[model samples]
Target chain A: MIHFLLKGVLHDRHRSLLPLIVITLGVALTVLGHAWVNGVLGESFVMSAHFSTGHLKAMTRAYAEEQDQMPIDLALIGVKEIMDELAGIGEVDWAPRIRFGGLIDFPDESGSTRSQGPATGFAVDLLTPGSKEIDRFNLTSSILSGHIPTREEEALITYDFAEKFHIQPGDRFTFFGSTMEGSMAFGNFIVAGTVRFGAEALDHGAILIDLTAGQRMLGMPDAAGEILGFFNNNRYDQKEAQAIADSFNARRSGSTDEFAPLMVTMRDQEGMAQLFDYTHIISAILITAFVLAMSVVLWNTGLIGGLRRYGEFGVRLALGEEKSHIYRTLIYEALLIGLIGSVIGTVVGLALALYLQVVGLDMGDAMRASTMMMPSVIRTQVTATDFWIGFIPGLFSMTLGNALSGLGIYKRSTAHLFKELEA
Target chain B: MENKQIIDINNLVKRFPIGDGYFTALQGITLRFVAGEFAGLVGPSGSGKTTLLNLIGSLDSPSEGSVVVLGHEVSRLSHRESAALRNYHIGFIFQTYNLLPVFSVYDNVEFPLLLQKRDAVGRRKAVMEALDWVGLSHKAQSRPAQLSGGECQRVSIARAMVKRPELVLADEPSANLDAKNSHHIIQTMKRLNRELGTTFLFATHDEKVMGYLDRIISLDDGRVARDERPLCVNEAQSDSTAEENGHARRQARI
Candidate 1:
């Protein structure tokens, strides 16, 4: 029976070609959409975790609440003790940063503020031979002009700010701000190198200084605004990260009398979990809509096939073929077409997916205008689920369409067969 | 052995709806056929020969009477029961040679045996024999559209006879054929009837078809106007013994 139906489909290109093309294109589009969504959203999430926040971070209770305000007064003190304890943990790397804001003075040989502007400052560990923080954010490639800073008295400033002040690589400047203890704090630093941060917010007004300089300038010894930690592999899972954070806190409770520091995974930091969930919901809605609309198109295709072949059905009935047999044969033909179409579409879609994965679509222009610190190229990622996801809708909707179309055969009266015969 | 009645029609009436009224195609028609007879119902255009044949074939039920084909009370049988009666006990050949256009000649001939659930080996044997009987063994792989009209009709005949049914109903089987093809078709059917003892009934006005029938039942205005035993040129009879022992009884028709 299957061979007979296959021959009929292969023989009648006029009747079967249109439906086969439609099913193939529909499945391909569905698979491409799923792969694109997973790729773009997955890359964006991982980039955000790597650059701005680590898989897990630690902050004092008061500091975590107002960390976004760059409150150096609420910073975690005695970070050395916390860093030592983290060293004993498994497969983790920790980095410390002092995020601050202060005025920078471009003095005119009189030791006075000739031209000054407020700047948001980042104080991170420099390459004291090898700083994990330098590699974590990939700051080396972001240099536009000068060399990286290696001394406590030298720093990297944004090229935009350097250009505004006509500051050269060896020029000196002063930063003055209130310390965490509410006392006057001052610093003198030479411009080491100008950098382009690539990120929109940071490129416009950033000042990077070594962690030792930031601690001295803020008048807080051995204090950091935040401690960021990532796994050795950098494959961050939110649930796993949260488990580590919770277990660390539980162990800290057993020993500490000083309100031991709290750990929070990246998702818990900024209501990011809900945002990630919404992306999945959007992807699901897109796939469901495509399936439903594709099913209706195929249902109409079945109806058209049936109406065109009413004469054939009549002849078969007159020749003593049972009505059920005729209807069932039509459905089996639809199943065979669906299987063939799905295989073709899957192969084509996967080919396109692999091409996109290797040769990504460049979004450099769009990236320049956005604040995300993501790579300029967006690529697709194909998985095992992509190959089979479209098959569910292909087989189910086509068979249902054929079955619905076959019901019309039962409505026809047996008298119609003889009338057709005499015609 | 040839006296067993396979079709019994009594007072059969068939009507068609015509613009809020009825047009009667067959009214008060009575007919009977036995196991191994070659018969044709002869008529003009408006006569009810084809309608009577349809009733006997159980393609449609009667409006007012009873038809019993192969033990089915035709009007009272369920759709499945009626289809089963047609599938196993009756075979049909039509004027248009309604061969399935997608199937090859071999497959077309094998259709009925497939419905009868014959084994693959038996189906192959039966299809080959039927094709050979119609002298179409060389055209087994040809499609209906590729065949000439006569060859298509032969394929149809092979399809009908492959199951070796007890009854064969043909409606205007030679209407579309030239005289040459017409003679070949009726001759093949006659040989099958004589050799296999299968009952044959036809509804046709073609005199070329009537000349080969063992019996002719003429219908006019939905009535049996004449019933006669016709002389078949292909049957060879011993003249003295044929006349002395009532030759019509040994001829082929009831």
Candidate 2:
């Protein structure tokens, strides 16, 4: 019986073709949009976590409040104690970092000032064994020339900054900055390499140095501005991070020290919560709007088709087929159509999404002046959920349309059908 | 089997709603049909023949009185039970040759058996037999759209006869055919009636269809005007002629 019905549907172009096409195109568009949005949100979260916030960050309460200003004066003391305590926890790695601003001076052969510029500097534990700082920053792949810092006085600057200064490896430069105690500090550093972080905000005028060199130059012994904790899997979990933060804060519960260590999750940072909420809302809106639109179109198609087949249904009813049986058969046919169309649409949509995932879209020109820490090239992320997401609207809308249309079967009386037949 | 009563209707009245009032289509109709009888309800358009036929077929319920077909009360049967009765014991042939356009003649004939849940082997055999009876075995693979009007009607007959139901209702079966094709369709139906012992009922005013029926029940203005058996009328005429011959011989002897 199903075989006969399938033949009927396949042979009758007027019955099945238009609805199939609509379902296929609608499902494909829905799948592609979902994956694209997911990719954008996932990438944005990863980029923010990588550059500005780790999975978790710990700093002094006073410094955290004014952390955006790079308050070296309120930097945390007894960093060795915090590092030791953080290291005892499993499934997490702790690293200390210092963010600072300084002035650079280039000298001529006659020992006179040639040129100078202001730059932002980041210092990490470069000389420590088994340190993940270089890999975490992805500096190995970002290096345009020369090598990473190998000594306390060695440093690496952004390739763009290097080109602007016409500086080469092994060139000595003077750095002038303030220490934690408000005294003027100075140091001479060798340019060991050049690197670019790909993000415009980080690659414009950036400098990198060893933690020991940074501590000595800033005159901040046994102190650090912030300590970052990264999960072993390199994926951020908001709940877990919050729990860890709560546990760490509870240890210092009621203390009056303004310089006490405070921990915060990545999502607790400025503007991040709104971004995630917007992403969720956008995904919901996009899928819902597409589904409703598809349903309306398919529903009209079903109603028109039913109207055109009034004679056919009349014949079947007169031939001893019950109205309920005919209605059920129509539903089965629509589901079959939905299944076929959804399969084809999923394949087409997935192919397009996979292409985007493989060969990402470059936004280098757009992001050149932007300060946001986002990658120059954006790629979509495909998850397991994308595989079956299209089936929801495809099957649901087609079945719903046909079910509404099939009600006409019961509305028609057999006597009227006979009159219709005679006519 | 010939005397077994298959349909019994008493004071059956059917009405249609028109503009907040009733348009009576059939009124005060009392009739009965026995098995193996080739009968027809003959009337002009709007004379309630089709309405009476629908009531007997259990397609509609009576507005006034009772209708019983195959021992099941037509007016009392639920939709499902009514459909079941038709599916198992009744077949219908239509003026328009309402064959499923998408299906071949073979499939159209096989459909009723499919509804009967007959196995595939039985369905194929019965379909071929019905097609052969209608002389459409060669056209079994042809679709209804590909066939002529007569051929399509032949397929319709095959479809109706495939399940070998106890009763067949044909409504104006020859109305859409030409003179020659009309005779051909009626002749095929007459042959099936003689061979299968299945009762056949028709709602039509077509003279060609009436000529082939053993019994003709004429209806007018939603009421039965006359009931006549043409063959029985012929037998009665012969008996009167024999009695007249005897009277003339006796008078000559006196």
Candidate 3:
């Protein structure tokens, strides 16, 4: 019976063609839209994680509250113990970093300052063997000129800062800042390289130095302002990060010291919680709207198709077919159309998504003036959900449309049909 | 013909609504037919011949009185029961040939057997036999749209006869055909009646159809005005015989 109905549908272009095309296009748009949204939001989260937030971060309670101020006075002490303890949490790579403010003075052939500017600096474990900081900061690709620091007393400065100060690689500069204990701090460093991190805020006046140099120059040994913990998989796991933070905080719950250590997940900082929540809500609303709109269009299509087949329905009914049977076949026909259309749409949508994923749109000009830590080129991320997202609207809208249109079959009287036929 | 009664109508009345009032299409119609009788309800338009046929076929119920077809009261049967009666025991042929335009001639003919859930081999044989009976076996794969009017009607007849139903109700079977095609269609039905022993009842005013029926019940203004058998009779004698036969059949049914 199904085979017979299938043959009928295949042979009759007037019945199935328009509905199939509508379904295919609707589903394709849905799949591509979903993938595009996931891609943009996913990329944003990953960039923020790598540059500003790690999967997790640990700092003193007072420093966390005043974190935006880069308060080195409230920094974590005895970082070796914290690093050892964090290693037991899960698959994580822990790194210590110090965010500092200092003055960099370019020196002439003499030992006196030629020019000076205030700068923001990140002191990382650059000299440590097998350190992941180089990869984490993506410094190799961002180098505009020169090389990264290869020895003590060496540092990397931003391309913009170098261009502004007319400082070149292999030149010497004096760094002057206050120590954690509120005393004077001073150092002289050779400019090893110049780099650009792409983001306007970071590339403006940034400098990078070895963690050991930072500790010595700031009169603090075996200490860091903050420690970042990144997942080994290079993807953020919210639940695992939250679990670790909760457990770490619980262990120190009794400590009333203002300087006691605390842990925070990436979402706890930078308003990420609200951003991700909005993405989820938007995705749900997008799919629902698509389904409703497509259903209405397909419903009208089915209504017209049903009206055209009124005579055929009467003939089937007169031949001893129950009204329910005819209605059931309509639904079965819709199901077959939905399945075929969805497969085709998914293939088309996924192909477009894969292309965008490989060759992302470059927004270098758009991001030049932006102070946010967002990447210039944005690409799509196709998740498992994208593979089946189209089928929801495809199958449901087609079935619902045909089911509503088929109600007319029950209202027709076979007697009246026969009378009309006789006439 | 067998003496077993296949359809017994008792004072049947059918009314259709028009605007605010009712238009009576069949009023106080009483009739009966035995198995294997080739019969027709003869009348002009609005005379209710098609209405009476519809009642007998269980496609409709009487507004008053009863229509008992194959021992089941038409008014008392549920939709499923009526459909089952039609599927298993009855067949219908329409004036329009009403073949599904998308289906080929063979599939249209095989439709009833498919409803009966016959096996593939049986269905194929039954459909082919019905097609062969109508001399359309060679055009089994052709769709209804591809066939001429006469060929389309033959396909309709084959479909109606394919199930070997106990009763076949045809409404204006030759109304859309030319005289030559009409005669050919009526002849095909008559031959199927003789060969299959199926009770054939037609609702038609066409003289070509009347010439082939063994029994004719003529209706006028929704009432049975004449009932007779044997085509070549004197007008006065046929009228007198129709009255006597109708009265005798009503008495026998009571």
The residue-by-residue lDDT of candidate 1 on B207-239, one tens digit each, is: 677767778898988888888774533354333
Any idea what lDDT model 1 has? 0.79
lDDT of 3 by residue, A174-266 (tens): 898999998888988999999987566787898999999999998768788989989999988889999999999999999999999999999
**TM value for model 1:** 0.75
Q: In candidate 1 chain A, where is summed lDDT lowest over 10 consecutive residues?
A: A251-260
For model 1 the local lDDT of residue A144 reads: 78
lDDT of each: 0.79, 0.83, 0.83
lDDT of 3 by residue, B150-226 (tens): 99999999999888888999999889999779878877877777777789999998766776678889899999998
Worst lDDT run of 10 residues, candidate 2 chain A, spans A414-423
Each predicted complex: what DockQ?
Answer: 0.38, 0.46, 0.46
| lDDT for each residue of candidate 2 in A1-423, tens digit (9 for 90 to 100) | 887788889878877787788778877877787788777777777777766778888999998988878888889889999988888765788888888888988777786778789988888888898898888778898888889888999999988888888988888888889998999988889999998876778888888999989999998788888888899899888888989989898999999799999988887775677776886798788767776776676666666766667678777776777888888888898898888888888888888888988887888788989887777777777888778888876777778778877787777677766566566
The alpha-carbon deviation from the true structure for residue A94 of candidate 2, after best TM-score superposition, in angstroms, is 2.2
- Alpha-carbon TM-score of each model against the true structure: 0.75, 0.82, 0.80
- Superposition TM-score, candidate 2 onto the true structure: 0.82
Candidate 2 wrong stretches, greater than 4 Å: A9-21, A101-121, A125-222, A288-311, A363-376, A411-423, B41-50, B175-180, B205-254
Q: Arrange candidates by DockQ, descending.
A: 2, 3, 1
